[model samples]
Target: MNTKLKAMVVDDHPIHQTIIKQYLANKGVNATTFGNVTEALRSLQGNTYNIIFCDLQMPGKDGIDMMLLLNKHGYSGSVVFVSAMDDTIISSLTCMCRPFTFNVIGKLAKPYFEDDIDKLIACVCDKHQSKASFQKQIEVDEREFLVALAEGRVKNYYQPIVDTKSGVLVGYEALARWMHPIYGLLLPYVFLPIVEKCGLSPELFDTVFSNAIQDIKLHGIKHSISLNVAQDNLEDALFSDRFLARCSENNIDPKTFTIEITERESYSSNVNLYKNLLKLRLNGVSVSIDDFGTGSSSLEKLSQLPFNELKIDRSFIQGITTEQKDKNIVRSICGLAKSLNISIVAEGVEDEETFSLLEEYGINLAQGYFIDKPMPLEAITVLNKEKKYV
Candidate 1:
């Protein structure tokens, strides 16, 4: 059995092309070499190659154009560009021309290491052999602007919140789960921080909101959707307007939605953050100080702003069954929320003891892996059908 992948090499340099062709041929690959784009395009029309290698700094038609031409021709294989420029610039070019072509696997700088090329080819061949590959196949108009585009991929998962008093379903927090082509299902902890760091929090938040609204419409359940909005994102005037506009576009009522602002972030003694929270309240969206009691300024700032809800951080709810200090903290938080007419939700209530204790403290809502683990949107649909509302 001959298992060989055909590879096409396109470069103006005779020596580099020869080296690549020889290397690929020696490695049991069917190697074809072309000195220009015309020959490469002609060969592509006549033959099928698993991958193509192109020189970025070509004379008439550059490597980027060749990649775009391959994309325009609907070639499904990967393209690898060789260049003397930095990989970052090539990556940017790839993003720019991604909509036009799918062949550029990556860019390789000049002064090539034979060993590195061998490794790269090996990785490409392995992907071709793998049954489960993470290569994205979607074609967008402007791939360079895809990160800002609204039509990427979306996945919605439900994290249930229960009534601690009766283990009844009160609502579920809609969590936006991204099934990235390269990265598998990512938790909020993994990508949320990175998104925030990259100054893309507003786009990320919009993606989350779009998915949440879709889920609510799909489930047809009157349950509330609690979403986290970064303080910085909320502070942006455009963000506030766009968010409200998106809600209007999706026909989601503000009454059934809650925006969670981290207590640690909102209570920084900065007046601007508080002002944004007040704007959220004025918009009729419930503003909850999330992870309450996790910060030193939480209790002091509770009275300073109009927070409609308080979420007791999981740290307080965890190990409460065994520790009196935990119980005391929960009691104090509940007392504070009640005194302020703020709805209290104890997050991370995993055990029966914690649940019962929370109900004793008059905590109205609870969520954790104890009552029910995070579930898919379909599972929530089934659960909603079975739930008997009081």
Candidate 2:
């Protein structure tokens, strides 16, 4: 059995290439090294690689220059940058590769040690190994999604959010869980587009939302609850009406529920979206803009819309403890949210250090694995009763 994963390293410097090859070798991967992208391109004619370490500065044909040609050559393997460049700039370049169909995994800044490169190699290997397991995506048709929705196979799990200063459980975010009997839980990324394409987002939303609030009411759960609002449902003229009716039916206050907008495109020219959002606001339901700093028009959206809460995305939160740039951005966002009188919630709060920093910065609410993972309603109801979360 030939179990070789073809790998390549493209660096202008011979020493850098040697170090990377050694790292790959440590992972039991014998990598072919190229002094420049030109040679790498020439080799691509005869052989395909499973992973490539590319450098941005290589005389004439740099990594950016290789993007189009690589795609033209149908190179679909994962690529990581081994360049003497700032990680931020490298990240932007990686995004640029998506347009050209490049499978960029990540980057190793200048002076990266063996551990850095080894991590990338391990990622490619693990991804290849796990594609047939948990990472496996089963495509269920629109009809099956409808059947699942009708059969109540779509479940709701709530992740607890806490008040940063008081350490009191303030709310829970209702994450939709569609459990397939054989494959188990299908993440939203796997199942949602199909639901949207099948024009069944509204139905799915109602199923999840109705179940969540009904559970909350039955258990006398006092914490506020958040629902990730899909644009399709938000655009419906009857959205706010139906949402409010459901709350009323459950004898739950609209003020206890929040609708979160996650997508950058949620800030659209669509009038119905705005109208429904306004109606929700008028009824005392809060609206939060999730992943606040990710989009180009985030500030403009803040000025143009009615948002009661701003959620700082996890990308910024993850590094606040170690990265000064992350701290600076988090501080600025907190200040801006304060000035606008909008409460700020920090998502992806995974440690005590980050949570303390967020509290010091006056973040109102925080949630992540540090606090708790999303769990079934029965589990959270027990916590609510015992006040264990506080």
Candidate 3:
């Protein structure tokens, strides 16, 4: 009946710490305050708090350092960063924490209002409720991922990519899902870094590719199936040959498939990667630039690489409905792709408004929850049979 939340506040400034503690107290949260990162981290070793409020500008150890240490210590609670820093710096630090596996709840800039603190507390509490669902995902490691790959537990879930104007299912993007014995269904983010680190990406890709081919054949679907390929896969000398051979054995048309290369990974100067991609294109397999606008030097890569499709990143697409800047960015990207004679696919089109905006921008394709969440092969087969996906 208490309904009290456990929280920790780490700040060198006594006044700010008191402010945060008082703010959290008002929200029915019992908060423990610390004046230094050392004491805070030591408390973390023995105590489990639902949320941690970290100050970015602290003496001895800053918030970023504490965040890295939190990951090192395997702290899995939500972290809220409090700083007077610029929005850009806060955004960058928040982004950095995510890759380290920290659950960044929200940020409180300096000169904070009481409403801001209230919002932060509410957000933290809301996120904490869902923490249990993700706790099992945290237990996954490279060994588990390797076992899953070897046991043929990696499965493909297909999300249909539709033509924007016609609303016709044009293709399906193969997303990897691991059928973990204990965890049930695990998304790619849960184990992909480990797969890449353990050099098992190619194996994982092969598993997904084989399943996708079968799914296409089983359903007698004629549309293309796009598979995400890593930089290492492209760098492999025999990758092209192996891929083409698999398609040949499966009796799949290379034209009915696409290889998606993410822009986040650097492939600008990889001669071998370029050669392999060129080989795929020559053999009728199209290449698409995935998450188009988020990466550095995207335009440069676009001009240099022989990609036929440009996927507008989800970040921009998700914002188009509410943010003017996002709309402008999506429009510009669509224009650029059109000028180059490249087809554009906007990812994360989650609403009718966003979909209409994308259509207005002349985006060639769209894919997201608005159309359909990724489905298992059986569901896809049903949809194909019913022809209801349009």
Which candidate achieves the best TM-score against the true structure? 2
Displacement of the residue 134 alpha carbon in candidate 2, Å: 4.2
lDDT against the true structure, per candidate, is: 0.73, 0.83, 0.84
Clashes of 1: 4
Better of 2 and 3 by lDDT: 3
Of candidate 2, the 10-residue stretch with the lowest lDDT total is 128-137
Better of 1 and 2 by TM-score: 2
Error of 1 at 376 (Å): 2.1
Ordered by TM-score, highest first, the candidates read 2, 3, 1
lDDT of 2 at 205: 79
Q: How much is the lDDT of residue 275 in candidate 2? A: 92
The digit string of per-residue lDDT tens for model 3 on 271-323 reads: 78888889999999999999998788898988888999989888789767754
TM-score of 1: 0.58
List the candidates' TM-scores in order: 0.58, 0.84, 0.73
Best by lDDT: 3
In candidate 3 the C-alpha lDDT for residue 106 amounts to 73
252-359 per-residue lDDT for model 2 (tens digits): 889998989874654676788889999999999999999988887898878877899999999789878865677889999999999999999999998888888887
